[model samples]
Target: MTAPKPRGGDILAIAAQNKVNWSGLDQTCINAIRVLTIDAVQKANSGHCGLPMAMAPVGYLLYTRFMRHNPKNPEWFGRDRFVLSAGHGSMLLYSLLYLTGYDVSLDDIKQFRQLGSKTPGHPEYGVTEGVETTTGPLGQGFGNGVGMAIAAKHLEARFERDKSGLFDHRIFGICSDGDLMEGVASEAASIAGHLGLGNIIYIYDDNHVTIDGHTELSFDEDVCKRFDAYKWHTQVVEDANDLTALSKAIEKAIKETSRPSLIRVRSIIGYGSPHKQGTSAAHSNPLGVEEVKLTKEFYGYPTEPPFFVADDVLAHFHECVERGEDLEHAWNAKFAAYSKKNPAEAAEFQAALATDLPTGWDAELPVFTPKDSLATRVSASQAEAAIGKKVWNLFGGSADLNESTFTDVKDGGDFERGHFEGRNPHFGIREHGMCAILNGIAVHGGFIPYGSSFLCFTDYARPSIRLAAMMELQVVFVFTHDSIGVGEDGPTHEPIEHLSSLRAIPHLTVIRPGDANEAVEAWRTVMTHTHGPVLLALSRQKVPTLDRTKMAPASGVRRGAYVLTESAGRPPEIILIGSGSELSLVVDAKAKLEEKGKSVRVVSMPSENIFEKQDQDYRDSVLPPGIRRRLAVEAGAPMSWYRWVGLDGEIIGMTTFGASGKYEEVMKHFGFSVDNVVERALKLLAR
Candidate 1:
């Protein structure tokens, strides 16, 4: 049986006890987190107050009692990572960060949800010192935590190579009821369990209240049972307010060391406010000024002082700064000893930890000639395989499409329970889960994670990809079957608008490599460019590798767009532009146009994003302002080509969903044919 809910006197007695056994400090810190959340929400007049308010005890226990994180150096490799998967309740994370003596200040908290403030509406990765990943779309953080746990396991597997206890930290996450309800979380949870990621521990805030009303109106499944089905170690803390049970549950979870653990804590939605407590009203929206005052009095807090943080509470939390520094220092010393014993492993470990790859890491990337048969996906796989061999930190997998996507690092061990040394992760068929997991891997550091699936499946994973772009994570996304060439499977599998849609997301580098050599260069660019995630759109059908000797070398793919074949004359009358599968089509048409005495320039524009980043002079030199007459060809949507073709030019592209046919027939059925392109270019030249 669980302890009964404490009455007013019992609560006060618990709070007033200063004895070391039940020292009031823990309660004070917990209450401090609750009050800070309430005050910040009221000030913002727009925020989720219920979760932070209710889960304060669990959050307090995890931060003060369990996690080994350095507030002074948030990037310490040895630190235990904490992800707030229930990111709408960002105040929960912000309050902990501020209380723990991170760079987040009282002023930052005061400016919550304001412009130019570190405390945004959601937990953003780079903007806040302690925020691990950007999460607001419900379950991305939960999936991300799974990725982090997997990364930790991979690190131990690859480097530890023994029963040595170095790199023994875990990943902790605070998730909401809504987080568990999201499909991404379910997908990630199942994989984590299947892989037996013992380092993952998630505390589900089982408030049982959704936005519409009671979860009974919609969500009513035994979450613990569901997790058990997924093969996870599970527990339920009967009371959200019970600190001792929470601590014990977490400690037990840490000891299991075989399966991921899920501790579901039942709690009131809004704890303190008399009117809103345990209701959906408390879930979002701020308590009124009067309700705020009433809530403070109810929690035994001073109503006069808003955002008040107690000194003893502050001191207690600040100890984390010192504790973290000590942990990192000790780990550093151990690493030094480890380095002395195993110099090669130590060097590899340090290099992985550092974001930069070794000099000339891409020196061995394949350079293809025309003789290298239809080689888009195959070439990408070759380049990635070479990278997987050299970089200890390079790790990733496909979303059940490894064979088709060509993303499997050949012979790179498959990551699973009891096999941590493997570099490849089996994310299963969960594209959404796979991408979010990659986000977790990226944010966790020490690894450059990539994920692959059919280009059409980007729809399933767009939310996580958006978060990756928003956080500017260095995740490489390998998307194959860039066009209607997916064939046979018909319209559903073919990606028409995916290219335009992905290109529009800010900070995302979308590169549709045209052939084998461009695919190699695209991977090279992804390694050197660390600002954001790079999306590589590879061809499903074989695209002939344009011989580098006769045309511009594929190395120009890094420039985004390059003049592959120039007109017989200096200033070409017309320019032919293409990306991915269509570049070969453009090249074929360039031959036809050249035969017709039309001086044409063929430009292989792999990445519009990178090309746009080029200086105007460089851009003009490649696309030239003098040539208004241009023909752009792409098997996908023509929206992105408008800028290059100008208002007067034409785009030989798909006008409808592709017909079910062979890849060649599909390309021909759509006007991507050579005759159509030559006919279009002749008209453009005449105009």
Candidate 2:
């Protein structure tokens, strides 16, 4: 059956017209999104369809009118960011990208929710053009948006001066009830509000329906009131179908320069669905052909058309491209004039846009010798301070652990609402926000960012860490008081599962440096590697520096695992493996083994993630395959060593939490001493 077509009209004419009189141009464009979403899900047989159908107009307005972005240059630094916090509505994002001349194609849209398609079930950061961040796990995108807003403020403060709006851009996000309900969002929203990030605006799709039926079933709270408590500017639109109201609300949001804005736009779930509108059934499964056809008909769309776009609708969207180009051109002209006036600042701006690290950055890393007895956290602080002096773009702060984590750079000023250009940021006691903010800073580019907190509190930062890994961002995480060696802090303050749990993450680099020298090497490794996020787990107590003359050079830390002490003979009968503070115990065990007429090799495996990246030849060179006799020691979980120690090997590590006692007493009680390591090694060797 052929679909009916309507005549052309102006925006006012279209808005005034009733459902029956509505033009095919308007209905076709909206229904195209509905049809493509349903078809894509039907093809892949997996995905949520309700969100795209309900929020199509929101996506349409942002893509066809407001956002200033170039699909051709998705990585354009000046482009506005769009984060889909409700990632289940990925089809909505994919469809918009396809129509807006982004890299996403018709074929990509059709292949949605399928393997190898750029349009994944959820928007992945690097995999898709125009996807600002990888968002799944509710509330993360909210935090990510805060990070982007913070970045915008920082950049504007640093680059935009005297009629040069170099970094004047907004960070917009589409959030849902689920996103707002997550605690991380609350944490991020508080910080964003406290910082007065006026450039960040979020459109809340207040669709009363959720996957488990009405949102009232699980979530029933005044969202506007919650945001208001965070000191954010809030607004409400009674109807999502009212485009004029949305446009006006967005304009108001943009105009506000004192606080972040949250425009609560009440929308019905499955807006066009004939029967499933405002129902949970419309949230995930595809509307059947009959239901979908009825939905199109209800929206005054052609009944049989699929992925069809009217000429006027195409022209309407083309306005966005033209407007964006004009904006970019105006900004470019302004920048040219600014460059003529401020030559040095312009050069710095260009260098930052290029994302180029300073030359000879490694030369600034602080080094330590055997005579030095310093905590790895202290070393990290010194190294970071030295690096910060050379790299002006480096910026970050701690989650109220600046003193304990030693993350504060000397002489760096705090980043405040009026002083975003300052280098240091005090994230207060919010760990989740700090991590999410770091991810934002890294994603914003031109700045190398790091966040710090006690290792035990990584649980609070885990969600952000996962998002950073998903985005493959280069944010550094400084986690101090790495283990039970935190002494009097008790089990609650000591981290046991953190190192292993962090190591389990696919793209995260978890490095637990043994001493001051290794800590310097670890920072160098972090500065050079851009694959993903890096976590530096440091000890609270001071550790003696390893003897480089008798042990492997600190540079070996880059290899992940290296031979710290080699056997004098052809090969050692037993191998001892350790990391961080435990390496000292293994070194002592090695000496004891040699005195007992046994040759032993001591290996330091600081970062299992980096070690795993090493070639088999290098791995075998460090831990020869022939030496089946091995013993692994670490203060944390024993489960992490089974891979390094083969079937016949033994691991001496804590299987449970430590007690409240002195660090030495806890180590002894947990059998983490040199005597236990030597005993375990002898047992393994005898076997």
Candidate 3:
């Protein structure tokens, strides 16, 4: 394969000159990765083993030569990120992480796919030290790589000055035919290429095989041309085993510097497996005892030793430890010099790297009063603008819903080709990509990312959001047009079961603010939050700002639920509960019931997950014992309300999709009006 002409300086020439021939040590290292992968799957009696065998050379080259990483301190800020998008071949990553000494022990590899083992079915982020992000659902890690690349560029632009390369590093990934086929990767690639994120270089394991059959059966398109259309610089290495050609392709990708790079490395499936090589059997099935012995013989490995690590092979791979230590030490020296030269900027930069927000960042967050003009509470579009002015770590954008979703960071500018320092990133119409990119930014660290779109599109973004929750990423998702209040656009645009569907994801915090002050508190809770991802579902219709002087302060939102209006007497006879746009309807209905001298209570539950975390005593106090006559209301689906309202309690929620009409007409038609709320309360009391 001829080398592509480099567009950068003499760096390409230097890299090519430094490249060495495929040595005996290199082959041993590559074979080690392959054998470890083979042994892992054979021992576990599960997992895909072919892809690891095919991509061993690329893995060896990246970990030992091309990638910049410190395995000892896997969280080192300057280290390059490696994402295995084809995570079914997780043993490959596990092998590299263990060999390079990132905390995965030999025992972990021996226990692949076992319960309570670090080596699970997939590479989970926090469970393993060197695993940068979780991967299992195909294409998620592909899009995550794009997000990491975008974050790297943004930080480089924001903090780098006068050759202080404090935040300079690349994101590398190995994706599969399955990963590229997924729509999320396509969405992320379009935006990544459009924005000229040149720091990403992914190796496509073009092995022409999948779980079902050869990719030719289903996927038969010019992948290189497709990426070219996305403005990516694409290359192909016919032989994945050719170290010289693969190294040249990677060096040129680094030097291209104006677009993301994809190096399609064609490789043989199950290389060295005498019978199974290039066949579907090698894709997932373990080579039987006889076949495994023959395969080892082909590679000249010892057939008797199951998990052998030759001393030389171990030394070659562990060289990464010393190399990494030196690399970080050099960067540390430069960081010290940078700190001395720019003290204040350096201090701020350090704090950002630590993901620390100023103690006062949320101090002046907006406080809405009833006397304040009524407005759509979801219009907290100003949330980022309000907190971002003081905390620079807050940076994000929307998927072309910028004006509508209210997620724009004003004056932060658009994160485009030449102005990556801008906080706002225009994600175009790629909602799935927007969510995945936000996960990337949150995992990349130094930035608290938030992405927005209409609530109905949560279907498109659910997979990435699930991964964020699984990884416990600290991201904020701003979903606007929370309910059918997004009228005139019809049922297609409205979300009926979205609230319940999103709440289904574990470790995800869903907060639907009731009014303006609650919206303010929602954003405040997000600003200092350091746990899993949080979703703020805001409204599009006008919602009344409550009189806090007569009700519980909006700060009660943090507790997930509070008595917005308590009963006139202890142990209320009946309770009315609501959240988001329907909250005011219940508030109005409570007043109507009180006029009849019946004891009544009004509850605003913005977040069910947060409320679940509250002590049982707190929960009982809010809902209380003996108050079995409960009427809960919301504009969305009500399945999740069963736990709070009890089996005997009644819920006022939509049974069907919404209709297109004026906002007020739609609310009245759906029984979200004050009259319907009072009527539901009365009916529950009569029961």
Candidate 4:
């Protein structure tokens, strides 16, 4: 592997000018990114080398020339967001972070893909300084980018005055074929187009290669055409190697303020590799010592040097860091002047960024007594309207189910292209896009966002949900018409596996409240817990509020699961457990069993996930180990109840799809009734 002959300075000049050296300065910086990516992957012995090698020029042009960000204050609200949606090429992002003087260092790069290191195999939000969102799952980053774009537009609308572009910022993402192929991206793209989010720009690395040799093996759809179908503005760069073309394409994208832009950049997978430039081998595995050496030598890098940075190249890259800081500082000064000029606007801006809930925010959460009757969905809407009034930053929309889900913010106007200041978002029938954009809004930082649709429709947003959990984003998903109670909508609308399935995700909390009061409690719980995403599954049918005087207080709802009712004496002959609508059944069953000379206790288990998080003493207090004769009941699948019900327990739940009928008739047909609950409890006690 011999160095290419000098084309333009010293040894550094020779390496930088190899090819595509449009600007000597730009060339040095681009090569610095390329070499850093190669060396990082080579040192770590793991990582995808193809994307970083191929997409370095685009990334270089964006970060160094276009994107406005501060390396020093990574959390700066005014900085433009850059998401590497093709997270497999994390090395590319990490390399840029290291060179452009973000908090990431050469040592951090050395620790790539290692456990406990900030530089993981993929970009992780909150884990690394500059990582916008976690993007290991394909297409999730693109969806998140949509969310960020929405955030930028909304913030700019709310805060940016005519003379002062106070909240102006752009969201940039690098997506691969995998991102375009994923359904979440399509859903998010459609919504982005509909919303006219011009602040967003996505660069597609059209390498046409996947893990399975070639993308042609399975993927052949025209991505540009598809984006066009979604009503997005599109452009194609004939060569990824051409920096000038990439720069001009980005400028055009920035110029268009009516639509989001996608720049399809064509390039080889492993740009400078000697043997595996366009093959599957370059996708994940190392390029090997000989091939890597040859690639570095071919680009005029010193053979003996590893992780080497030429002073001039380092100087050129540091300019980005300086420029980023200056941008932030300039914004800060402008913001300070704006605050003096318009105290009211400045206060609103500061208040939103503070993450503080408005005073008396909880005043609107209607308190329900045992005598009240209401559906959890209705109760949730009441709570939402109350919170929405106090927390002005809270914004969201439903998937054309606002009336059904009760998710509309009262008096809040729709978020349109021209009206970003609106609190309510009309997402139409796009559940997937609603979830993705909620994540984007949350990622944008100032707004507390939520998305709503039927519980069954959660399937449409599953990928986005998974990404939200992975990113530990604080986006809320309000899923109404939970369980068979969705009724006349029939089997098609009912959510049989969704509750258990969403619970299966690692960092997501799935909560289903039993009544109006518990629904309020569920809302309170979701607001207080900020570590990850929360899914609120609400019922469509009215449920009687649990009698607080006769039962445990609604406060225990925060415990996930708790003893809603206690036995008359020391320990009960049998324990009855239920969640959501079925909790009412257990409450009624407890009365009949007690009348029949059986000591019975009913526990309202709203959230199994949160219950599991409690300490054993608390859990034991709720469900004592001595009580083996327990019966768990729910309207949906029964698979999740075994952990609480014990070895001798029985779960009276739906093992099949629901029937078409009224909600009450459906419940009766499914055996989700007091009679069935009493029978199950008696059988357990008899045993």
Which one is best on lDDT?
1
For model 3, residues 358-394, the per-residue Cα lDDT tens digits are 7677666666667654444343755556788789878
lDDT of 4 by residue, 1-687 (tens): 443332212422322233474867676677667777787788889889889988889888888889998888889988989999999999999989888889998888889888899899999888999998888788788888988888778777777776687676889999999988887788788888988899889999988788987788999888889889888999988668788778889999999889999999876777778677777788998888888888887666665577788888877788887898889889989999988888987887787777667677787688998678999999988988888888877788888888888888888888887788787888878787778778877877887889899999988888888878887877789999899998898999999988888898999999999988899999888877777898999999999987787778887889999888866775688889889988898889888988898888788889998999999999998898998899988888887888888798999888899988999989988898889888877777777
The deviation in Å at residue 514 for candidate 3 is: 0.7
Q: Give each model a TM-score.
A: 0.96, 0.95, 0.96, 0.94
Q: What is the C-alpha RMSD of each candidate to the true structure, in Å?
A: 3.2, 4.1, 5.1, 3.8
lDDT of each: 0.86, 0.82, 0.85, 0.84
Candidate 4 lDDT score at position 474: 79
Residues 1-687, candidate 2, lDDT per residue (tens digit)? Answer: 222221112321232232222344654666677667876776677788878876776787787778888777777777889999999889988888877778887788878877788999899988999898888788888888888888888778877877466787899999999888888888899998888999998999888777888777889899999899988999997666566777889989989989999999776666666567667887888777788777777666666556555666666656666677777777778888988988988888778767677677667777788899988898878888788888777778899878788777677678888888777788989998788878878887877789999999999989899888878888899999988888887899988888888899989999999888899989888887787999999998888898888787989899999999966855788889889988888998888888899998889999999998999999999889998888888888877789999897888877788778898888788897888887877787777
Q: Can you tell me which runs of candidate 2 are displaced by over 4 Å?
A: 1-28
How does candidate 3 fare on TM-score?
Answer: 0.96
Candidate 2, residue 526: lDDT: 87
Deviation from native of the Cα of residue 496 in model 2, angstroms: 1.7
